[model samples]
Target: MMIDGWAVNALPGVLVVPAVAAALLAILPNYRATARLNVMATTLTLICALSLFFGKPQPGPYLLVDDLNGTFIVLTTFVGFTTSIFSASYIGHELEIGRLTPAAVRFYHTMYQMLMFAMNLALVANNIGLMWVAIELATLTTVLMVGIYRTHEALEAAWKYFILGSVGIALALFGTILVYVAARPVVGEGVDAMVWSVLVTRAGAFDPALLDVAFVFLLLGYGTKVGLALLHAWLPDAHAEGPTPISAVLSGLLLNVALYALLRFKMLLAANPAAIAPGPLMVTLGLLSLVFAAFMLYRRRDIKRLFAYSSIEHMGIITFAFGMGGPLANFAGLLHMTMHSLTKSAIFFAVGHVAQVKGTQRIADMGGLTETHPVLGWSLILGVVAIAGLPPLGIFMSEFLVVSSTFAREPPLAILLVAGILIGVAGLFLRLNSIAFGEPRGPAAKAQASYVPMFSHLALVLVAGIYMPPALVVWFQNVAGLLG
Candidate 1:
């Protein structure tokens, strides 16, 4: 198989641009220039990611591209680019309000690019160990950003994220080592033992017992990063205290990358017949997270935190869909993952601006949003509707597929899923009713906001619900087949 010359440049370019931007932004003193540079860097990185559709390099010890990761790469880069655009205006206001100093803004942009580099590396790495390293780097970058403000609460949130994230990655490392041990006898030493492409093809010959234990460790480890039920305590705080853009990325990008790593390992498990079926474990955690997060939503006081738990619920649905592991379920899982990423991020963007306009994150303080500020209010309504899995939205289509697929296979489990989703729907709309209608509260002045990024995402979600492109459906179907 021959690789295109341009494809070779594109993969390296995706990483190099952000790495270079992070270095450059660190030294550049002006906040305005740095913001523009952040957007430009992500834009260029997105271009490189897009170029992979033309041609891709062969699998190697260190990196590779395939249909599975190709979808993630494009989604990651596209969202990263749009979020950067939103960040420019969002952070500018923070600077004016003195909430963020120039130095903090500089560090923010630098870390933003660094986070992009790490995520892209994780997506492209062919080595599972190398993928772990990339996720750890991403975790570190976000941990710092979560606490950037240095407030007591911010520091506390960051502290919790760091401790939990560190433990999660450490467990993930143990799991990675167990895999290497299993593969060593078969693949024989060195980097080959840790390379994903090699592991999947050779996994059947490895020790099944070792592989089984390795997956349990891997699931618990990476599941933490995915914000599964028992592992989700750190997520809400991190979202509530971090900058809005960071909240958007945390919900939109980082969690998805973590899930991507889990999916990679899940594929490895699927290749080994004697090993434990990974689906049961995933289903348990996914169902648990969905139910727990749904009930938890009613208790949130902070607007940002409310959406944060919503991220957990949506991720649960995605994990559960994939756990079912058939053509319909996998296709539904793929679509839902993409939809959740877009819809959740769009919600954060609106919440960010809403917090800014109202000067508070407390839900009790915000009321009559639709009457006072029509654009942001209605935008928030659309986002909430999309996220709640309402009809005529992308999430609705994907979720319909998940529920229908589940009912055909497991009626009891389907009941649980439907109940969880309904409980979640009630909680979210309860919050929405108060936030978007009736008596106005607090400041009602016009908000200086970035509507393009928010509206653009919403439009895509709307279009996706109405009609999925033929190319995308084909891509997802092919990838679903591969997941088996």
Candidate 2:
């Protein structure tokens, strides 16, 4: 995983590979060729991201690679690479089934790479302004992809996402400006005022009033992107109507990217002793999102939509864990976020095939899946079992830590958290029963594509649940300590 000489340049490669690939895919003809090229480009970007471990780069005026973001970069690229593999098979079927056109898929491939580039740039960005630009770019790319199918539902979802996402970005931009203004007096105007590293070092002296207001806006803004409750209306529709691959990225990567931005600001607020404690605000929203999404999960009929709510609930858990900020809680939050991404994306992979095979996403239409397609059926069941915080799964370990830490520090909040988790579990298993076992219903046609990606992710989740490498434990512990 380590790289030696010349690997310092790998930082640029993470951004450059996807940017270049997007350009090439824009004109590339033929779905098969474009798809393989997409995978290759993403693989190269992942290699570049991994190299950051040994070839750590210095903080710069515009971009930097460091411990915290280095982990995020690697995860983002790895998932992007795997999702590309799934997208190839999924979209190929879409073409054959007339759900999409060759032209539409060409556009989809181009936007996919563009989205990866934007997310990478956001992660590596040293400047707040640059990060804002990168996040906005990523949002715009997903907006386009969300409507690629051009169905009425798809278009409506895209518009909803765009409108909501724009408002979120606007609030975020205002917060970014406030940060710069707060820093300008201390750090002296220009770019240095907006550099994230610079802001953290001098934040203690920045006006606490401005910092407080800035954080309020920043949380709501980025929380919208994170799909937190009260600000999460666009997420389910976007996930339900978009291509399944896009849904996977929405939950697995984009939400985390938004949370990353929010965490950076939380760190800034933490450095200032005079500023208000951010824990209460995040805790409130996190709990609200958890309870809210947990209840909403029962109302979902579309399979994709069901899991979309599950994502909101899991993000709530992660947020609540971080809001409770101790080394243990932060560590739990980080672990839960990673586990959720891997597990949820794997679910979407199975869900994608399930919807395709059954020719519908309606839960009522799919029954006796174990009898119909054992691999997909069981893979999805295992995914849900993992996501439900059951034992012997990655999420179980993370959720246990979250609940244990909460109980130790704040007993009442632990009760509420447990309530939400329990409700979510009941709702998910209720839905699972209808889909996984029963009298056969819907088409049982065998899937055309091999589901290696789905199984591979599940295998990782299984192993993580049982045992984690010492290196990963140390890495998460170090990052958790840094957050404090």
Candidate 3:
């Protein structure tokens, strides 16, 4: 089969290359060689993902590819590739400081590839069951990596993630089973009931009551992984304690993967008119998350944890956009999701370098960054501005779209959304000014890491804000229409 012109047969390579590279890295003891290999494997995987835009494989009972997930695959692999480059430099510094042994470095590289493989599988899998398994695998790999340093805080964070993550997986499993049971009557008790494409087509005929129950379970379950307000206890801790590269992937890629799963199931629910509207539930949670995280941002002492809350706030906005469920709103949601992924990852990249140079993660100890390290300081300032939803940034455009759309549809909710955004902006600038200006509080050494990945992401976001390519705009609009 062919899509835009490319052969569908190439799809498998995207999955296979990472799995093989991971195995190779597992056995290799040299940190330098394994690090280079990680970047190569991720780059190759990204190439395969990009090829999918040219052509896609036919959907099957266990695997599928379409405009919606095709977009996700590209974004996932691209961020994964950039993060690998950043990781190479970040990990090298850790080695020099004796914070990581050669063995741990090898293991970290292997697990990083494994996490990439699992995320790719989750995005491409056609069966809900397969997707669940893939997400669980990704979670496991991240948990191990988070605790790689074996520090007390690292272990505690990993344990929290594992416990909370396991509960989420179990809830999602039950929801999946309930969905199968709902479909069993119409599609029969077999593989057909588990297929996403098949389920959506036959959704109107399924028991609406059962779907309502299943959706609640699925939302709460996967919502945990999405870092939604109440279930988000694991998020800040994980970001604070894990390696910065892992934190980058967690915010930039993994949360989006979980939300993608929710969107798929939401599409199924929307297909059946008899089912309860999923919009209200999603909007409530999204708004709650935004407000809650915005308030919590003021209390954070650690730089990573502060941005972790920022992640929760942005995810809330994206979730709200999706939940609003119209062509304009959906398009805005997609734009916001893309912008947040790029911007947050870039912020983490800057934070990683700053922490290394200052020898601290404490916000109090990180003053006068601009005076001490102009490039790193200014890069971080740009990232902060973009994330604060300031003008001439991709995030500002997306947030503007969201608020305008919400106002046209729901005025009161729009007010609350604006308030949340303003609140978050206030908190971010307050901390940012302190970090980027003022007298230097701690020793500032020159950064050893490459600035290419961080600056590259910021540049893309800046250009996207100024001028969105016509083809890309059309692609997002097409997918937005599909969301309804």
Candidate number of the best lDDT: 3
Task: Write the residue-wise lDDT of candidate 2 on 1-484 in tens digits.
Answer: 2455556789899999999999999999889999999999999999888878886877998997878888789889988999999999999999999999999999999999999999999999999999999999999999999999899999999999999999999999999999998999999979999999988999999999999999999999999999999999999999999999999999999999999999899999999999998989999999999999999989789999999999999999998998999899999999999999999999999999899999999999999999999988999999999999998999999999999999999999999999999999999999999999999899988888658888888889999999999999999999999889
Q: How accurate is candidate 1 locally (lDDT)?
A: 0.93
What TM-score goes with each of the models? 0.99, 0.99, 0.99
Query: Which lDDT values do the candidates have, in the order given?
Result: 0.93, 0.94, 0.94
Q: What is the clash count for each candidate, in the order shown?
A: 0, 0, 0
Off by over 4 Å in 3: 1-6
Give per-residue lDDT, candidate 2, residue 405.
95
List the lowest-lDDT window of 10 residues for candidate 3.
1-10
Clashes of 1: 0
RMSD of each: 1.1, 1.2, 1.1
- The lowest-lDDT stretch of 10 consecutive residues in candidate 1 is 1-10
- For model 3, residues 153-184, the per-residue Cα lDDT tens digits are 99999999999999998999999999999999
lDDT of 1 by residue, 410-477 (tens): 99999999999999999999999999998999899999999999999999999999999999899999
